[model samples]
Target: MIYQKTELGQRAMKDRHAVEITRAQRSALILLDGQRSTASVLDATLSLGVSREDIDRLAELGLIATMPGSASADMPRGDAQLTDFASSTLAARHGPMDLPVAPNNEEERVRRYKKAYPLATQITATLGLRGFKLNLAVESAQGFDGLIELLPKIRAAVGDERVQPLRDALEGR
Candidate 1:
């Protein structure tokens, strides 16, 4: 079976390992869908923070697996819809209801930040009714931008009746 790391799985692994992992190791393990070889895994580990000895030890301990050459008929087919649904649900429930950190790459960063903004706004509006205040630092443009970006979504999420007070506050009315 191909193993792809879920966010929860990654958190569990990190908590269990408790050791710092190299970026390369993280990338390799994430991409391992049961097809990459030991050498590739090793390279990935090396790229991350792990030594050869550690990689060997992990493999020996059955933490990492080497894919066999033959494909198994019993393996589940890739379920894109399921994956998307699960990811969205997880993100909504567990992910920070705020702009994510700048992504590793420009395109991805923009995409994720854009996607997270509206969701965050919606969540924040729900919280605002309970008197949760937003914290935006003077030195952080991104923080301010995120707050401003979320205003419209928050308004929309709150709807006309519940959002008037918020709008009054924002407009100093």
Candidate 2:
């Protein structure tokens, strides 16, 4: 069956806030450009160890869809609705929106840095190897503002769902 990115998936692709997905899933997602057959995409992703399940998960996440009438007999079209993408890739969890001015006081800055830093690391850490660079970025962040600047990148990497924790910490939650 041929699969293509859904509107939700398209938005995820266009936006910088890419949801955090397994490397396999991300690879599959990139290959599922509508014209490609499921088997072809799968074949291409074999190097990445992507399987039908990973593709299915992308479908489940609503990042990709089987073209209308493209359903093959082997894979039953069940009642299951596609899931939104990971890490809004299908749903990027933007930690709070449009960041405001950073706390001016050193104490408050330090406090926020302490609070948000771990959350940021935790988020990037979920990506495993793909996240190593971003994890380092989180580590190099100097203070609250530096960490805050990284929020958008974080949101792009993991999507908004995972960003909630970082967002909460930034908001002093």
Candidate 3:
């Protein structure tokens, strides 16, 4: 069976391993881009001293997974739909948009709320009922999972290209 890197894996690579991963693990990780087979990855990483254990470690970290043939598959979906929805919604209304920066500590949260409120209020006013709900949702969002769950709704309110910056801010990156 072949394994592909998850979004978290891509984030790890892009962020230069925010998690505690070994050199061998990183070596093996750079090879599982959804196109390579397990055997091919093993061969490619031979000089880097990568092993099956490294691959297993990535899987354990939820950084990689097999494609959708197995019973216990965890395939990610809805990105395209979200993008489409965001595109259409923004195009219909056609106005200036200000993205909210997520807050970390309590002090930052206060600052963030101050900044986000005016923008949210202005935008939401234009959107009517949906806008009001989105403003409340943005203010009430909790952690990473909460932010991710709210991403689709946010994109629908804003646009497709703005969520990553907001997520990065939320992650304190």
Of the candidates shown, which would achieve the greatest lDDT relative to the real structure?
Answer: 2
Residue 24 error, candidate 3, Å: 1.5
TM-score, candidate 2, is 0.45
- Please identify model 1 stretches exceeding 4 Å from their true place: 1-28, 70-173
Q: After superposition, how far is residue 107 of candidate 3 from its true place, in Å?
A: 71
- Candidate 2 or 1, higher TM-score: 2
Give the per-residue lDDT digits (tens) of candidate 2, residues 16-121: 3666568778778888898888766654444345667788888888898888888663232332232322212222223225664576688877887798888888
lDDT of 1 by residue, 1-173 (tens): 33334454456366756545544345555555556544344333331333344444444444565455434332222432332222222234344223223335656545544554444444453543231332121112263345444444344334445544434333323
Stretches of candidate 3 off by over 4 Å are: 70-173
Candidate 2's displacement at residue 2, Å, is 20
lDDT of each: 0.40, 0.69, 0.57
User: How big is the RMSD of model 2?
Assistant: 12.1
Residue 57, candidate 3: alpha-carbon lDDT = 83
Top TM-score model: 2
- Candidate 3: tens digits of C-alpha lDDT, residues 1-173: 47888999988898884778988788778888777776557545543445566887899999899876643222112222322333333334443234444445677665544544444434435655535556666556553445545554565555555544553454444
